[model samples]
Target: MNGMSRIVKKVTQLLVSIIFMYGVYIVTHGHLTPGGGFAGGAIIVGAFALIILAYGSDALKLHKEEAGSSASESLSILMVLILAVIGFFVGGMVFFNNYLPTGVVGELISAGTVPLYNIFIGMEVAAALLTIFIALVIFKEESK
Candidate 1:
């Protein structure tokens, strides 16, 4: 697939960073805000989608032999599970327990494990969606 016109590429270049930044903001502030990991991840994926739309699948630069997105998704899932398991040993608690100190309310660092979990979840979701998007793009190209 070929990329769009120069104008589309320029517009996408201008907007992608802003969209990505908003996704990061949503992920980081999930504990105190309405939008959480899933929403933030979707937003990040949308940013990448915008790039793909403007520049085509080749813009991703993903090699055929490497499964980078899947690996990232797996690693993030493992990290989240490890964090949960650590809570069991450290606090003598069950799964999904919050062991870290909860600081002042309405603060960035107040939610302890919640923010950590959200970050991991965001990474996992973003990677998963990107992988799917790339796979679909590849399939579409191959079927032609």
Candidate 2:
């Protein structure tokens, strides 16, 4: 009742998984391709936004989403920072140094620590954006 038409909701249900998967692909293959963590994160959030728009805020557990996204954002940023700090003690004694072994060029695992960074960055960006969106939704409801 609060959301859009049934057709739109159905379409969203069908497309959400595909969109989410595409975003994950972009994040994972970022080092090999042009799209990276930031782009992928935006795409991932777009999927969630589409769902919310199609189903309305009442259909989803908004408070849980807010809490989860906030926690995810915090944890991901902490992991990223930890990875950076580890470089000082591990490889080159410099921040963000790649300590992991590199693989063959053009391979999926060739980027060493770069992929890890991308994954965490994608998580952080997605969670942060989701949290912002949730806050905006809450504010809008409160204002009304």
Candidate 3:
């Protein structure tokens, strides 16, 4: 899809970076902050959706991105599962146990497994949302 007016496209380009950065920040700081993987991932996906709106579906070539998103989602889910399994085996604990060291308070890496889980969840959520958006766009285009 062709892009919108030059002004809208330029504005979207500038805002997209800022939005993406905010999402990363939210995901990374989830353990210390109020927002976590889900919120941050949604924000990131929202930024992508904004781009799609500004520059139409065809311009983004979402088919390629859809595959990447699917892969990312699968990998993230696998990593989460692996982390849980490892935690169980190492400590003879239940799944999703926190086996790693808890660092200093108010620090970025303080929460041990929580932060890692948040990161993986963020990736999974972002990829899933992107895939959904791409599918919706494709369906819409096809129906038209």
Candidate 4:
């Protein structure tokens, strides 16, 4: 990478990290705070997008190639679906049900399905983002 690209890349990485951490903070405290699963998931991937823009196509080589990333992203989606189904079965009623007790507000373990959904969504978003980044980056490589 060029030197200016490297500096810009580092700054982007830093910003992305900060954004991801903020996402987590909002998600984890979603019950007491404003954000939740969807917000966190979207914001987390927002960070990934910055990474892609900053470092160019080669930045996410830490993960496998696009096909593997595709599989991983699919797996995370399937997992979320499976978990929701399992929750329904276990709850003996609604899908994505909060089977667990909704404890006091502001506690880590408070909102039941809220936290669970947040976690599943966060993971799914992260993996799917990686898949997307890998696909886009790999395309740039092939075009050369």
Please name the candidate that would achieve the greatest lDDT relative to the true structure. 2
The 0-to-1 C-alpha lDDT of every candidate, in the order given, reads 0.90, 0.93, 0.91, 0.71
Residues 1-144, candidate 1: write the lDDT tens digits: 378999999999899999999999999999999998999999999998898899976677755512988899999999999999998888766888899999999999987799999999999999999989888877887899
Total backbone clashes of candidate 2, pairs 3 or more residues apart or in separate chains: 0
Best by TM-score: 2
Which runs in model 1 stand beyond 4 Å of their true positions?
Answer: 64-66
Candidate 3 Cα misplacement greater than 4 A, ranges? none
lDDT of 3 by residue, 14-99 (tens): 89999999999999999887999999999999998998899987667778888999999999999999999999988766888889
TM-score against native, each model: 0.94, 0.97, 0.94, 0.73
Task: Tell me the deviation in Å of residue 70 in model 1.
Answer: 0.8
Query: What global local distance difference test value does model 4 have?
Result: 0.71
Show pairs that collide, candidate 3. 1-58, 1-59
Q: What digit string (tens of lDDT, one per residue) describes model 2 on residues 20-84?
A: 99999999999999998999999999899998899888776888889999999999999999999
Model 2 gets an lDDT of 0.93
Poorly placed runs, candidate 4 (over 4 Å)? 1-7, 62-68
Lowest summed lDDT window (length 10), candidate 3: 56-65
Error of 1 at 34 (Å): 0.6
RMSD of each predicted structure: 1.6, 0.8, 1.3, 3.0
> Residues 1-144, candidate 4, lDDT per residue (tens digit)?
532467786687568879989878876766777777667777877776676677654565534556665676677678778878888899678888677778887678887777766777776776677676666766777899
Q: List the residue pairs that clash in candidate 2.
A: none
